[model samples]
Target: MLPKCIGNLSTTLTAFSSGGNRVFGEIPEEIGNFVNLEVLFMNLNQLSGVIPSNLGNLRNLARLDLSDNNMGGTIPSSLGNLTKLIGLSLSGNNFRGQIPSQLSNCRSLDSLDLSSNNLGGAIPPQLIGLSSFAIILDLSRNHLTGVLPKEVGNLRALTALDISDNLLVGEVPSSLGACIGLTSLRMGGNFFHGSIPQSIRLLGGIEELDISRNNLSGQIPEFLAVLHSLKILNLSYNKFEGMLPREGVFKNVTSTFIIGNNELCGGLPEFHLPDCISKSSKSKKINIVILSTCIIFGVLGVAVILAFIYLCWLKKKVNKPVPSLINSSCPNISYGELLKATDSFSSTNLIGVGSCGSVYKGILKDSGIAVAVKVFHLVHHGALKSFTVECEALKTIKHRNLLKILTVCSSIDYQGNDFKAIVYEFMDNGSLERWLHPSATSSHGNELPKKLNFIRRISIAIGVASALDYLHHQCHFPILHCDLKPSNILLDAKMVVHLGDFGLAKFLLGSSHDTVANQMSSMGLRGSVGYAPPEYAMGCEVSREGDVYSYGILLLEMFTGLSPTDNRFGDNLTLHSFVAAALPERVLEVTDRIPLLARASVWESLVPMKCLKNG
Candidate 1:
């Protein structure tokens, strides 16, 4: 016998699973005292008696599986109180009575199985309206009767629905066509009459459909031939007549069972059906003539329209004035060419957005070269200046670690806007920001955590350093990169870092004027917050030393996995101060463990001491 003292352990219990135990006895009513229980699985047991109504006290219960038990009683109406219930399986039991309509209150239910029970009465309309049923809803092998409700269409996300082996009657609901996500539907072994609904064609993703052993009478739907995703189809023991489709799943006689439908004719030779006789030979000839006439007229109409549109496009091209390139060193790509390449600057092509402009991924039609087009938003303050500075800075510099500028578009757009765009070689991989902080949701709705190895981090740091070294010392006129951050660092297919975004770049010229730097310095802050040095906050001129300060912070962020702008840092506590406290001993605590593990061999030999000393 189960201990009644189970209620004493209920206060802290979140789960009580004793599945497949074959525990013979009535489930202790005290089991319901577990108010915090989220999962209660006692399946494959010989437990009997009424399910404790007190189980409803578990408001957090997400799953309650009591299948394969000898429990014989009405499902507790109080169970409906579990609003967070995602799965409720009471199958393979002797429970008898109408399924509680109160179960409809479980709005989060993804799977609900009450099969192999003595459940009778009309299927609950509220139960059929559960749109969250993305998994399975099996009520098969039961004494369920009456017409299937149109509310079944509300289960648009349902993948599988098995209501077979029941006493269900009346025509199949046409609203079932709204279940477009259904991959499997089983309504066989029932008394369903009338032709298959034409709306059934909407289930283009159906992989398995079993409507066998029904009173269904009509020609098989030809649209079934086009449901390419279908793998198994059973139309056996139905009253379906006429020719079976010879395409798609129907072509495979073994996978598609259509036995006992005596009137059915003309399918794949493997089906061994009687040949379909042609009855309207004269009408068929007239129909063919009409179709041929329509085809000729349709072809002629399409050709004329296409020719007129092409002529209009050519005339517009001839009238449009071509914009000149900013410099002879780079290619001269027109605004129209780029507009066509990026689908007129569609949001889908947009890759990144900054204070001054948005970057779009484009492929030139003429050369088939993939490029990144940085289009300046002229409406923003200092945007035009950023554009000019970038063009001037990029034209003078050339380095492996630097972003390669392919061309510059200083032109007016079709909308008569002051459009200025700079084109660069497209980076196959995205920015370092994404790698540093990967999102929980992806395009495919999967959690993808991006990991950067120690070696790759070192390589990126080295590449950025090389680009900075070139700008500060190797350039004809030393340039100061005012803004240097992870977002500005782009990676290629080989993971080679390209230091980009020279919008705030200042050229250091040995002159008395100090015009550009002086004007930019007056803007208060030069670079991103936390990245701009402390001196910059005091209205100091942007310099290579400031770049070095930002670089130090960037390096700290890469290794320690703590952003300088993280909420933890404040007035007294800075990223530098935080790291200083951790020092050489507690450095392991501050840094990311994953990369540290990857570079374990080099930690003592190369990284720790040097990073501590420099960082």
Candidate 2:
């Protein structure tokens, strides 16, 4: 139970968060006394009882989240008094009654989530039509009824919208297509009728769209097949008909779902859909004479083709050099070419060194394209295995925030020794480690000092998180980075982050198989010493959590400018604990001085840590 005395800080508190805790019992009504509170988060708790109506008294509140709790009772209309509120989430609760139309008065609101609740009644047009909703507006898994208001077009800035699994009826509003910022839209599990609106083509950037289990009919839209960004599309259990397009996402059955739509046909062979045939063609009867002639000709054509193929194979075997399996997936770059590109492995071209290899700046002679060449030292114990693992991992995964392999080189060097290398696009800004802690002996001594502002640091963090999310959840099979640290994070010209260095990558084959493989692979440490998780040291099986632990340490290091293995962290005191003990009050003491050099006061320096703490 929350202690009532906790509200005594109302006189000075500006923010309060107790989310994801085991706390229970009713919230203290005295919480309304925090006139200066700007943010309140108590989500993912066991709190119950009605929201204290007096909460509306906190007129300065800018964000309020009490979601994923056992809280019940109607949403109090008094909440309308918080005109400055920017986000309000009451989702995953037992709250009953209609969504208070008064919530529309929060003109600054950008995100409103009332999903997974017992709320019923028509979705208030005033609330749904709020143009201030720029981030998301989720009312899914509720008892909402009536058509989505046409005024939804007013929210042209909204990025995601979900009204799935509701009592909604009528056509999907064409006005929704006007919100061109949408990346995900789900209106499935409802009674929505009619064809997909033509205006939907305007949302060219939509990535995940689900309109399944509805009454929508007509040919599956050709526009969907042309949506290059479309990844996960669910059109199942609808009345869609006609030939499914063979282009774009339709060609990948694993990412697109069309099951239960009986009339749909002519998709990928993996879909096992019936061949689409015109009515006239289906009704025509073939003559026996023509059929026999076609059979004879087809056999003759097959025999001729086989003979030609065999002759071509024999000639090629004698005339051309066969490509290696590694070269088959990548461009056919010879070891000699890589050697020339790196100026015969000159010391001047060396940019970074790794456990198994050295990365050199190089330029392809023919194309004049700048590249980063990672040439493995084959003599190193695990260098061969590292090169193989990196190639296997890179070939299967591709994402904007993850590094891209341009080609691979596998052949004999001038000495007739095995040579292995991986080439990647050159990053102008270089690795995160160089910026976070510049070396006094850096080759570029004439260059000015480098620093990352608060915003840039946050952007880098988000990019790294996105890359990890893709590897862990969005791949054909789960992949674990195993190694995530500052040195592995690269920055491009625009300062966009790209996660690289996958030599320690591991594919999770499934639960039991993964455990056995992990144990076998645990013969050595999975990642660098300080960044690896403690459980890994005990021979625990590799899991996604291991990556997250490394990411957490990376975050602390990013803001504090202190490595996990920094000498200051000794005895029982670690970097994480050192920072944790100085937060909210002594935030500036532990934070890197670079971000604070331009700040005016202690309050200004707290911005970054405040956001991290609240989240």
Candidate 3:
């Protein structure tokens, strides 16, 4: 009794021609009586009982959906008799046991999502022939194991294929790269360890590639650097070694991206990691404290005062042994004329602020050259000595990564207020910290875009290190960047890095052995707490190792894509402590955000944090 057969047949009767009074119970096997039926859709009811094997009598049936009901037991083997069936969806019910492979003879399935169930065993490779031209394949989040067939490349028109979160292994078949139109590849978080094929990089149009958290080895092919169109690339926590690709997409990025893998090196100064110019140009701070006899030592406050005095001295000494912006005699612009051009110290034109004064983006009245004009704090009789020392030190030192102080402006305001200002080469990109976490400006989108990748991040680290190397070993006198942090390192138009804000501690102590250094061999106490070397905090002498610690923190930030103080880390976690926690094992726990997604897409689950700790 298949419902009521009297009202059930029409030539087009197909699946449900007659309502048959909507009796909610077991589908009667008698429905097989409809010999001319071409479609059957008896799903979503309280129907139960085995699908009658005799139902195959409907030779013309093209679609069958017996899903979402109380159906049970094995699929009727007679379903193989419906040679015309093109669509079959019996999912979401308590079907039991093995699927009869004989059904593959039907030869026409276009879309299938039979996931989220207990159906086990390897997907029969022969099923690829079932749909000669259909698309949309999804078999994710299941327990199915064994290697997927390389024969899948036969689906030349596949736009999207998701086979993630499974126990599948074996190399990602090179044949799949034949899908030239494929985009968004995720093959991370898996045990498919091997060098990636160059054919994948040959996919010129791919925008995002994640192959992190795996056992990949060998150098990242230089060819990958050619992916200029890529927006995010993740290859962290793998066994990649050697320097990063220094050309193509690797060359132009400025973000801190790579981390985890430790063998990577090279990337000399002026070397742009993949895309950034090398370590030769990235800025470094030199903290050389010269404790002086000055009173009112509120420490930070007095340091501020000392910085102000040296800045004044820095004016006359902008360039002595070092090259000056101009070779000619000092071009003096009267204070009155600069006052007028700056609109009487107007706040609107103000562009920056520093220890001793406010910086205004000003135009010189004499030559009309646009420059960043830093106006120091007011003139004081007692502070004049410290100011001169800064001017002189900045003048004698010369390096491409150091800021270029142009000239000074001095004059009296209408109220007889004494003013002094120094002009410098305008850094259009502002500070490194700002660029890394940029605030959107009116002209450019704010927020540092995910432009940095493994190669570029390494380049940035090396560049900063190189700068510090020069200060510690290459300079006439050793200098320590007492205040090293992301905020003070600056970036330029081409994403080249530069050092700014030279501290004046050595100046307040009056120069020479009286200063922090006795000459070129000075090992002084200078640096900020967060990035300061451990020994320095313990009252031991500072070393390049302190700068190295800061650089390490900076490196961790780039790789983890998290700040040193993010909640993701425990309370005692500095970037060092956090990274150390993830080290020797469990390193997969640290990843750039973009790569994490890629790893999950291309691999199994979040790589077991156990890999980091146990392996």
Candidate 4:
């Protein structure tokens, strides 16, 4: 909303020579006709529009600053014609374009900035001059590409250089090691490759350094790892390889430095890897070995030997157990007793696919107890990680409606092997999805239960919403359920809702970035397509609001018997909008018939863009 032109204002006063005068409003296009104007000082103004091309007529212009404006569009190419120009800054504006290479021809040009714009293209290579003493240079966040020219090393006077966030590639020029006077160097989030030049290792006066999120490879230069004066060093998400030399640098890192590479393994503190192999792969092999020993001994051992082992194992089994996703008995469980309880885990005893495992209804003969046993899948590492996270989270989760995790066995069989499983309080009724969208029912594949009535459906919806709200917002750390479909929600004997499946739950309390949910654009369109929000496509940093959006869609489906992702959203559409349109005279026509049989909210608080949102 800056003033369009100066002539539109009431003031036009030419000040006495050599006096400092303050002026307001935007520069007029006609002002370029100030033919004798040699010292233009419109540095900070609420100005709009590009500097007039006619301003290039100031043959003797020394200092020019049209900075801090609402200016849009390209910097005029004509400005470079000023042969006598000294200081130039079009900084901090909406102005965008490649730095005119012609300005470098101005031999006397010094101080430049075209930062924070949507400009694109490569930095000009031939622009560096030996005679010109350019001081400050900043060209960050533009779409500029290509390598930083080695000629820049010739700028012995250049104290600060920031070309961060551009598409520049290649190694940090070796000659940069000679720039001992450099106070700040920020080249983050680019494609610069190769190791940190060994020559730069001697930069004793350096204060800041950031080379994160780039393709830079090779071990971090050893000399840099020991620099005490350095305040910040971020080499995260790069291709840096090889075990860090433990005795020297990186020994006392205080700030965050992520070095997670697939090959850079086993050398860290948490990952106690053996010299024989990498940590992750070694853990997998150890698990395999433990599994083999348990199986071999189980088949050959006699009853006496088994009894001795069981009592001995019990002493070690009752302590806090290792985390697991599938709730099952301890690894050294009484296999024979469990087998007898399930009639040898018979097909008749099989229940459902519970999470990453198969569930079986078992009754202990000795105790006359009913329990559900979930067996781990043969090959599911994803299921394994999920199992571990859930075990940890559920250890603290104690809710009446939720399915309670009882215990899990983490030992090997008589053969001296390891198998994972968990035990949970069983539910007579399965998931809500089974009743609402029943395809098949019962382990015998019998007909699904009768369709739920309106009253029951609303109850289920309310329960589901409450569970979702708790998980999404009320938990100690807000847990984001990336997947929130009906099948994942279960009900108890009392018809109380208990949300299951934290396989995709992410703690959002202090997360700086949205993860897992972001890398889901492929695999036939991400996140169940219809349920995912629109902003997800733009990678706009998803929040708990996404879960809220999914819940709203579910509520809409509960009342309308139509999927929210259906093709009826905008054409006089949306369950909420459609229902609201039929208000006043006949709210009945707009009602979700299931709720018609029960007391409804009356939607007395409903309005446009209200709680019952469509988008």
Per model, state how many residue pairs clash.
0, 0, 45, 28
Q: Give Cα-based local distance difference scores for all models.
A: 0.83, 0.83, 0.57, 0.60
lDDT for predicted candidate 3 compared with the true structure: 0.57
Total backbone clashes of candidate 3, pairs 3 or more residues apart or in separate chains = 45
Residue 44 accuracy (lDDT) in model 1: 91
Q: Could you tell which candidate, 1 or 2, scores higher by lDDT?
A: 1
* 182-214 per-residue lDDT for model 4 (tens digits): 666778757687888887765676667777757
Cα lDDT of candidate 1 equals: 0.83
Model 3, span 141-223: residue lDDT tens: 33344666777666555544555434355676777666655555555434355677777765776666666545667777877
lDDT of 2: 0.83
Candidate 2 Cα deviation (angstroms), residue 335? 0.8
Off by over 4 Å in 4: 1-26, 33-46, 59-62, 128-134, 202-204, 226-229, 245-252, 259-615
| Candidate 2 segments exceeding 4 Å error | 1-330, 511-523, 597-615
TM-score: which candidate is best?
A: 2
Model 1, runs deviating above 4 Å:
280-615
Q: Best to worst by lDDT, what's the order? A: 1, 2, 4, 3
Per-residue CA lDDT of model 2 for 259-311, tens digit only, reads 77889888788998999987777556445557777879978899999999999
TM-score of 1: 0.46
User: CA shift at 254, candidate 2, in angstroms?
Assistant: 16
Instruction: Indicate the residue-level lDDT of 492 in model 4.
Output: 70
Q: Which residue pairs clash in candidate 1?
A: none
